[model samples]
Target chain A: MKKILTIAALALSFMFLTACDSMDSPSPLDTRASDTSGELNPDGLPGDATMGADSGLQDRGLNSINGFDPENINPEDIVYTIYFGFDQYAVGSSERDKVKSAADFFAQNPDMKIVLVGHTDWYGTEEYNMLLSDKRCRAVSDYMGNIGTDPSRIEIIARGEAGATMDVAKNSPEAKKDRRVDIVKVK
Target chain B: MIRRVFLGLFAGIICTSALFAEDAGTIRKDAGRLNVPIYRVAITSSDADTANLAKRAFGTHGSFRLSAPSQAQFIFDFAPSGGNSVKLTIKGGTVYEQVFSGSNSVEALMKACDAAVMKTIRTPGYFAGKIVFSYSKNGGQTSEICTSDMVFRNVRALTRDGNDSLMPHFSPDGSKIIYTGYYRTGFMDLLLIDLNTNTRKVFAAYKGSNTGGSFSPDGTRVATILTSTGNAEVWTASANGGGFKRITNTSATESTPSFSPDGRTLIFAGDYRGAPQIYTAPATGGKPSVVRTNISGYCSEPVWNKVNPDLIAFTIAQGKGFQIAVYNFRTKQTKVVSRGASTSGPKWLNDGRHIICTKSNGANRQLYIIDTETDSQKPLHTTSFGSAKEPDFAYTAR
Candidate 1:
């Protein structure tokens, strides 16, 4: 009787051991890392982390801005309002003071170049808007040249009325502010 | 005796299980490279699985197999099948029937299938050619002078220093190209560039816009649209840019000039009748004559075929889109080459079998070569996502 009981016990232990072995074995799918970011991460786990440590990886692998973060930009670069009258590209008295301040900043930094991007309100066809925008840009470029700035250092771009005139009414203050030039410094 | 019987039963059970396990494993074909599912079915005389059927349904089309209980799976290795849609019927663990259906004709389908199997078939060698044109890359708004492929591949910015380059004309031999580049100092000059050598030379430094250049058949003189006296007109000069003479006196915008096969007459796009139309004039000085009439909606860019000068192809804005229409000077009848909603910039190949034109999907433009005989069109290049405008074909460079 003891012999029979021993045999049965051995068989049961064998079956249990086989089941445990099967459960402990790693799956083939688990060998590959999860693609949660939807990007083809060729180097796989720990290698990717080390390579991307210097720069935080953007969603599309774009390099993150080092020091000049858009969120942490200085308040001086943001000009809230610039007013222009109908069919006019000349700087008014109030806007001239602002432009002078911009010019002073550009003059202090000799190596810096300025980009004058002109815009117009939605009052004409696309072709005419492009022409008007050119006129406005030329006016700003001429103004900078008269103020003793190098003509080659100043770049002019015309944006036309494509991005001007928000969903608000034309009589609104924001609408008037949209018809103007944006000055940006380029290094 | 009972112990021996138990031992025998255990051994028998293990052997049977081992056999079943071997049968359950996937059977591999092609030197164990391709693993296929094992199927079992009874085969009768009426439901016989022929080798051809096996080759057609699974092996030739894609990887498939047939097997019976305790037998190795049978694999058929046949030529690759063609066509987009395929139908197959399996009977008794084998493919008994097959049918193919697709947009391609039978001959084309067979050819495609043969190509897929051999992997050596290619489109005609000449189909991968390109045409160079002057385009505005930068410098103010209209500082044109750039070269692009027929389908706008590898768009290289040739001149970007704010000079206005216009009316690019290829040399007769197609080894060199000529154009008028206007400088900021108001000096209009004729610039010539050897395509192979990449050597540039300023031939003529004339006053006003020295535009609308065309190469003569014998490659001796270049017919150009010059506005010397404040009026746009046709002029000719030696290929080396000497002995310049005015050919016409028109206050209208006389631009886009081309030469006849014999280089005796010139066809240009102008607006003498209020709207832009095609007009022909003598290669020497003379009055212009209207070529086509009745139906008109801004027709321009008249390019004469090298083989047949009587057949002139130009672009016309018809319906909601622009189309390339050919005008037979003999019949005075116009026929549309491209059926797309937007097409322009018609240029003829040296053989005159096809004309390359710019086709647009309203948002982006691509280069398409249309066969003149059949009126069938195909994309020239496979890449590029921007607008490719103004194509001018030159002869295959020697």
Candidate 2:
């Protein structure tokens, strides 16, 4: 009886020790990593681009959207398409030149309006990918806003993981081309 | 003459003893039912289409084992009733006859099979349901909403936007389909397709990502994901696409808000606790509590069982791929249900015992019907249908 009791106690202790060791304090915070994919620069602030931070959207020279169609814009009319990392929406410093290039094109064509369409690689769930695409779009629009463009002029759309490039290896560098945002003129 | 009479009497005595020996507990003491793993059934139909449909229906279920008529405990005999219906006479376990109707032969035969299951097994049979899924062609460049019977026949596109459409789900009544499409605006908007009216309209186009539209059990409300706040949050609207209200007030990007069978609760995938996990909230919107699946940190795409309220199915990360897992609310334990080739996107069949999901094949994927009870996968399509994903099922009586 004593031996049996001892064995049972040992078994219970081992189970307690081994049970849920994986649940320790946010096991593998891929959630945080994915959430922070929309990280902003210097402090990831202004992350809440709610309706493009809509407290003063109309006050900030909001453009009227009546007969604008992004499909009508030619490939050459597009200033620059922003590219992002895997599951990321952050406009990194490397893409600053591209954002500036779009902003410069805007300066050249003040009468025209530009549209931002966001997309992602087909790696995550469909619904989340849809939101992530929007996050990337809002991030670029916010970037354009920071660089002196009418936030209203930048009509944003999210294509999610649509049109994912599959002609090359998925893990290869060329796949980054799939996670991009197009900057088309919507005049 | 006396010897002949004695021999006849002996034969009669021998026959009487043989009959007595075959009585219960008198012979074959080990002939018990302790070894049977599945129900043995025999399916026979004069019509080739009916027989083929019945075979497909019974062959894919794990609870049933198709066998010869002599060895089966149940026998299903089907007869053509009309152009697209069948009259099934089930003989064994319980004897009954039922007339099943559908829009096509496969659908009708499936309904008859489901009737037999209900009459014999006393559990839900989901073979006669319809599935709405998004099929992507041109290498995932553009997708269109499509619907088909459970057998993957009767396939037709609901939307030919020529741009992109995805995450198609059926209303409770199976008369409408709700999905997100890049219709004209180049932005993803919640679009509704009423099968009865053959008309399409925008359900929700609230200035940002509007997707993940699902119907409540009563079909009076819709649960969706809205990004007007710059983050994906659970929101509900009226059945007519009015009375918008946000359900979750958090920075954690939420997706896929599924209502419980009782229509009193909502389960969704969110990163509230720093990672993606299953969480539940009141249908009227309150503090959300995480469901401790404890299976993985990357659990998402949760769909609540419509028949069994205690069950919720989701996708869990497996190595570099993903697999389907089920969580029981009563036991609070989670178990993996499906395997192989980056399978994800689980939606419950009406029986609550099956799920319609997708399995990846490199860049393209295909739809599969999974028997959660046995982890058996039956591909809905043998031929390629491009990349089919995000499947939702609706069960309606014809």
Candidate 3:
């Protein structure tokens, strides 16, 4: 009985110490090197590399990068989607690369245009979904403009929960597939 | 005290056993509350096709019942007139006769028979009208707007945009259909299709979102929810998609704005207080008041009764499923009219007693007409169409 009591007291002390440790310092934010892959962060915000003092993509215009031949570039190969977090409209690190690519393509082919279709999952109010989708398009448009894509070349359409990527349950990881900006190429 | 306790226990047993009865209270006790005459109809025809078509049209009528000719108050008689036409006569205490033409096929004949039934009964007819709803294929990856007659015949595809097209609503006069269609450009634009002209145009493709377009009673303005102002708000603009103005501005998301019969007010679904509830505001735009009748859970997709202004039909979400419910203004009581199945998107027909709603079990969703007066439901039989939803009833054939 004495031994059992001693073990119980030690276990309680250890749990208390662990709880104090957790309360003393909360989990730090993500601090890894920013991903350079052309994709969006699940959190729908810019990565650490894109937020630093002077190395942000906003400072680098399309003219700074080597332009590509838009005519030779197959739309199926160059086309990519930029996903947003739930109810969010911010451009993340990965999506920034795709926007830069689109800007570069348009720079080489001035006559071409890129259409950004905004969509949302079947989760919120239909009206709110429309607005959410439009916000996503606006976020992409602003990013394109920041990178030197002509405003005339960027056309936005907001489809409110009409074109959902995943028809599964709402707010699930699969449903997030629907809340994205589908980038299509236009001549 | 012992004797009283025994009696109370015995009475509780009897009440609990009564709950086991099936189809109890299916037929409403106060049928006269609808103020529409109930007629028993008997159909007879020399042609097998005509007889079948007539039965299908009046089988689930809200104000009519199928009965034997001897007991029926009215009898419908059909005879083949010539190549693809029939003459119909309805005999009650008085005799009424008419010749219907261009009914070569079952589809055409059913429509003519439905029109004849309504004309004979002297009620505003909906049997010959059309319904526009959304249909999805490839596991809902792609959707299109489709319209069919009341019996789900003569279906026609309105938009072949190859993107996603849905939420087709007929105009007040049934001359046009307003819906949202996704273009290749990746955004949804409100498109209006003129049925009379076979022409379509983009109604509102605003910077943000232009959707939920509903016409006012006067047909001069359209009440819609737009995000051009950075938040979802109800707005009214010209029927031609000009003269745009904002109506509601709460931080909460507003959607599915339904104009009342008077066009003076609009009822919409919103999460005004953290949970979805129905709220009403002026059609011209102003502060909204919550419509808290008897519903306590989330309610959305509200539609006002066109003929009767006293009742509102909406879909209420309850524990993993939705049910069609109607709220009575006079009694302030909400009654669940659909039973044993999940339902959504209830729209009242012109009769004000029948409603078109989607009955689904998550796997297959089909449109079913629910007669609120009798608590009976009949599926809208669209041939070979696996799934259909979001039914909007039109009173006239435009």
Question: DockQ numbers for every candidate?
Answer: 0.02, 0.11, 0.07
Poorly placed runs, candidate 3 (over 4 Å): A1-187, B1-40, B65-74, B80-86, B91-95, B100-122, B137-140, B361-364
**Alpha carbon deviation, residue A76, candidate 2 (Å):** 2.4
For residue A147, what is the lDDT in candidate 2?
88
DockQ (model 3, Cα)? 0.07
* Candidate ranking (lDDT, best to worst): 2, 3, 1
Q: Residues A1-187, candidate 1: write the lDDT tens digits.
A: 9999999999999877653342222211122325333222212212111111111111111122222222222546543234677546667777877677777778898887565656677543222333345456556666767887787675544455534543344557665766887776655
**Of candidates 3 and 1, the better by TM-score:** 3
Name the regions of candidate 1 deviating beyond 4 angstroms: A1-187, B1-125, B128-130, B135-167, B180-190, B203-205, B361-363, B382-385
Docking class of 1: incorrect
Candidate 1 lDDT by residue in tens digits, B205-258 = 432334556788888888776543434566777776556667777756566777
Q: B230-251 in candidate 3: lDDT tens per residue?
A: 5567877788656777788776
Question: Which candidate ranks first by TM-score, i.e. highest?
Answer: 2
From the highest TM-score down, the ranking of the candidates is 2, 3, 1
Error of 3 at A24 (Å): 68
Could you give candidate 2's per-residue lDDT for residues B217-254 as a string of tens digits? 99988998877766788988877766777889887788
Candidate 2 TM-score on chain B: 0.87
Docking class of 3: incorrect
